[model samples]
Target: MKRQIIASINHNLGRAIALLDVIDSKTYQDTSIGPYYSSIGSHIRHTLDFFDCIISGLDTNDIDLTARKRDEVISTDKDAAKDHIYKIQETLTSYTDVNTDYLIHVTDNMGQGKITVNYTLESILAHANSHAIHHYATIGYMLEQLGVSIKIPGFGYNPTTPVNKREGI
Candidate 1:
């Protein structure tokens, strides 16, 4: 189960790299570097931030972390983004794939008097997958605003799309 789930996480990370490759490098660099939710690049950085945290948090429950910090943009340079993607992929593949019965500790940010839950590491992996989708949509919107379009692979071949649909009639 852990191996299968970890593979899915890495695959999503690969898709992000492929889709972003379709976007212009200059635009990727010139886009705003921000901590605000209004910025697209910030969202992408935010996704990577959690990727790092989850990778780390899988082992230690004591990392000083905040969700907002993950949302802040680290860099606008496409190379930086690519570097992050590669590093995070390395971490995910190196760690998650090997741990089968490892436990993950989950809690609300900032110790807000909420009960913490113990989950298998794969649940956190799924959270990152969901976040990647949201940020990918954000990037897709930002590209549209810049009059740039990415020929992303999964956007049209979804389960309901014609490319994925089969003839039954």
Candidate 2:
């Protein structure tokens, strides 16, 4: 289970790196699209920020989502985002011996106000993986609008998606 979870995290992070590699800086930071109007860089930064929060808090056992670093350079610079992604990939790899059963507190805003809930490290990591995929899907839509075709497979697919339904399956 630990190996599977780590693999999923690395897989999504790899897609983020691939996205940076394929898209130019202008396309990455563009916000000309209608509706939500979020850029691919924004989605990538947001996804990485969540993972950063979890990893940074692991030793302290106080995973505070509300206190995200929210690095602006990552949102506007493809190189910086890729650098951060690589750092996260390295961090995830180092956690192979983590005690997933250990309970930790995750603090986040929930409409009413801030709330801290007890969660296992395993559960929080799983949520982070799913969140990355969700943001990747939005990035995929943005890429479509920009007419940039990325060749990386499974960039935006949920793990639960049937194997036959995924691209290049």
Candidate 3:
């Protein structure tokens, strides 16, 4: 289960890296697309922020979702985003020996007040993966609006989502 979770995350991160390699800095940092006007780099940084929180809190067993770095460089530079992703991948690789069932406390605000809840390490990791995918879908919309074509298959889709529905085919 640990291996599967790590593989899924790494696979998605790889897709992000692939897209970054193809897209120029202008496309990555462009916020001119969509009603929200969020850039692709912003989405990448936001998604990675969740993982960063998890990695930082691992030793303490207390994860704070709101403690994001939101670094400007990460939100505007593809190389910096790639570097952050690589660091996350490296940290995830070291978790191979950790117990997935270990309990941890997670704190996050759900449009209300901040709340803390108990979660297994595996469960939080899985949630983070799903969260990343959700943000990737938004990034996909931004890419389409910017006329950027990415070759990574299932780049922003959940594994259980039908390909036909996702592609409108």
Candidate 4:
């Protein structure tokens, strides 16, 4: 299960890297798309920040989801965002012996107030994986709006989504 989880994350991160390779700096930082006016870089940074929180809090056993880097450079620079993604991939690679079932405290604000809840390391990783995909889908929309043709297969889709639906066939 741990191997599968890690592989899935690495694959998704690879897709992000591929995207960065193709898009220019302007497209990465473009915020002219929608009602919220969020850039692709912002979504990428936000997704990575979640993983950063997980990786940073692993040793202490207390993950704070609200503690995000929110780095402007990462949000405005394609190279910086790619570098950050590479760093995250390398860090995840180093955790070869993590126990998936280990319980840890996770702090996040779901609504009215901040709350800390117990979660298995596997569960949180799984949530983060899904979260990344969700952000990727948003990025896909932005890319389409910006007239960038992305060819990376399954780049912004959940594994369980039907192929026909993903391709609009």
Candidate 5:
């Protein structure tokens, strides 16, 4: 199970690195999209922030979802984003054999106030994977609006998506 979870995280990190190969800094940081006006880099950085929180909290078992680093360089610089992705991939790879059966406390602010919830390491890791994929789909939309071509065919798809659907049936 840990191996599978780690692989899923690595999969998204690989896609993020591949994205840098196709997009330049200007498009990466472009926030001129209409309506919500979110930049691709913003989504990418946000996606990474969740994983960062999990990894940082692993030792202490006190994961705080709202305490994101929100590194500006990662959001605006393609090279910085790539470097960060590589670091995350390395961290996840090291956790494959670690015991994840213990409970982890997760804290988050849901508009009204802060709340804490109990979670197993495995469960939160699963959430982080799902979270990254959700943001990747948003990045997909942002890239499309910016006229960027995706080199990875299933970069943002859910793993449970039917194989035929992913292949366009």
Candidate 6:
């Protein structure tokens, strides 16, 4: 079960990385219409930050994605963000590669109850995917407001994605 979950996360993260390839770094720097620390750039950065946090505990790889709260610029280099995200997924798969029956408990920092680290990993993946969707949706709206059509092909596949399978979640 763990192996299958890891494989799915790899696939989903791959898709997201592909979609991100289409995002102009400039677009990432664009601020959302009305929100704090809610620009496309920071949204991407934050997703990386949060996932890296969980993956650190996984001890597969140390992926630090935290950016200055005041600076919303997507890493001037988008590849770096993509590379880091890629590494996170890779390390996760490697970590789970040998463990088919291991589970570690950790307190849920925000939820109502405690859960296992393995479960936390899945939850974090879901959160990351949700963050991506929010950023993508906001970027879509921002683009439309600017009179530009979304260039990404799969943006229309789901108006809202709750089932983000194959990704880490």
TM per prediction: 0.73, 0.93, 0.94, 0.94, 0.92, 0.62
Cα miss at 95, model 4 (Å)?
1.6
Per-residue lDDT tens digits for candidate 3, residues 76-154, read 9899999989999999988977776667999999889889999987889899999988988888888877777776788
- lDDT, candidate 6, residue 7? 70
RMSD in order of candidates: 5.3, 1.7, 1.8, 1.7, 2.0, 6.1
The whole-model lDDT of each prediction reads: 0.62, 0.85, 0.87, 0.87, 0.84, 0.54
For model 3, name the residue pairs that clash.
Answer: none
Q: Report lDDT (Cα) of residue 85, candidate 6.
A: 69
Q: Model 2: clashing residue pairs?
A: none
Q: For model 2, how does the per-residue alpha-carbon lDDT over 1-169 read when each residue is reduced to its tens digit?
A: 8777887888878888887887899999999887988788888889998999998888898999988887889999999998998898888888887666778999999989999999887789899999988888888888888888877787788867897877620
Residue-pair clash count for candidate 2: 0
Q: What residue runs in model 2 are displaced by over 4 Å at the alpha carbon?
A: none
Give per-residue CA lDDT, model 5, range 11-33, as digits (tens): 86788888788888888989988
Candidate 3 or 2, higher TM-score: 3
Model 2 CA RMSD to the hidden true structure, in angstroms = 1.7
Candidate 4 lDDT over residue span 6-70, tens digit each: 77898889999998998899999888998889999999999999999999898899899999989
Candidate 3: count the clashes: 0
TM-score for candidate 4:
0.94
Off by over 4 Å in 6: 60-75, 100-102, 107-135, 151-169
Candidate with better TM-score, 5 vs 6? 5
Candidate 5 has a TM-score of 0.92
The lDDT, on a scale of 0 to 1, for candidate 5 is: 0.84
Question: Ten residues in a row with the worst lDDT in model 5?
Answer: 160-169
* Clash pairs, model 4 backbone: none
